[model samples]
Target: MRIGTMLGDVLRSLFSRTATRQYPVERAQPPTQLRGKLYYDPEQCTGCSLCVEDCPAYAIELITIDKTKKQFALRYHVDRCTFCGQCVESCRFKCIQLASNEWELASLDKAAFTNLYQRAENDASNVEKVAATDVETPDKE
Candidate 1:
């Protein structure tokens, strides 16, 4: 009986394909609904910061612009990200999205794991510093 089982195993090994993927050499595509990385579209973003507040992982930060836009000028962080999709669900503007970047996440440096989320303006222009006009002025002497 043992000899027959060993023969069957040998034949199975010869005919069956390998189960593991080659990783970097051959990566599997993530499913359409799989939440991999979160991306933010600045133009579509309302700067409501709802995504920030809704983040259970506290991975998101919102830096606001002082102008009338009332929207976040720069927003990004990946330090403690749990990859939870709560933030995306909270966004009413549909600015947040789950990106397909599944395999490139590993990094020797801890900071590399962080997914930087930025708005469209942040990509084209530097973050503008708030001017003194926005600050409360002291009473006249």
Candidate 2:
């Protein structure tokens, strides 16, 4: 009886549709309201740290350049982000948005997920300053 049942199941399986997604060839469609990656527009940012404060995962790292001027550089750690949309909701300046369409962020290395988002106006000068500070350590050689 067991052999008969096994044989019947195997025959049914041969005609059944595949139950797995073809990820590489065909992408899965995320829900319309899915909160995916966080999009930060630096020009709209007030550097109020509301998003930083509200994030449950502690994913947002904000470097305040000038509190009076509201200049901020946001370092988004995607690996630690929970996609809870709390940061987006708490942002009063409307600078942070969760791009629901940007969900294909898979990577092998954790470092690749650390994305730097800032306005075009502040990027150049901040990049230079960060680079200068990074290279300041003396070589052991």
Candidate 3:
């Protein structure tokens, strides 16, 4: 509160380093296992809905085409995701994964965060159907 003490404090403030960073010039590297954007490899997925079933936040939804192949039509709506990595961990096939990509999430509408992923071939479902049938055996009494 004294005038002389205030003047001394003001002098020290001018020489101190800034708390803010120079951002663009000094980019920050994300840590290992940093949860950023979610990425799905269509070829790796089986449309089993295991990731959807394990998601704690219910952020994942599985949409499939009802052909003989039972192909996955879409995998969308990740905006409500909490980045808990539960879906990633639950994927037995290593189909679900998160990309290191970050910083494009901002948008005026909430819909902007929703990402869409679609599968090309339907071989996964066919494999499932074959596996299901292979487990059965005729009973001989």
Looking at model 1, report the run of 10 residues with the lowest lDDT sum: 131-140
Off by over 4 Å in 1: 1-4, 114-141
lDDT of 3 by residue, 1-141 (tens): 999999998988889987776986876787767887787776656777777777766676665545346445334455777888887898887877776657356678876666656555555565345434442221323
lDDT (Cα, tens digit) per residue for candidate 2, span 21-98: 797797778888988888898887876677877777878777666558766677788988999988888988888888
Best-first order by TM-score: 2, 1, 3
Alpha-carbon lDDT, every model: 0.62, 0.76, 0.64
Please give the lDDT score for candidate 3: 0.64
Compared to the true structure, candidate 3 yields what TM-score?
0.67
lDDT of 1 by residue, 34-80 (tens): 76666777666666767777776666665555336654543445556
What global local distance difference test value does model 2 have?
0.76
Give stretches of model 2 more than 4 Å off: 124-141
RMSD of each: 7.5, 6.6, 9.5
The best candidate in terms of TM-score: 2
For residue 138, what is the lDDT in candidate 1? 21
Best by lDDT: 2
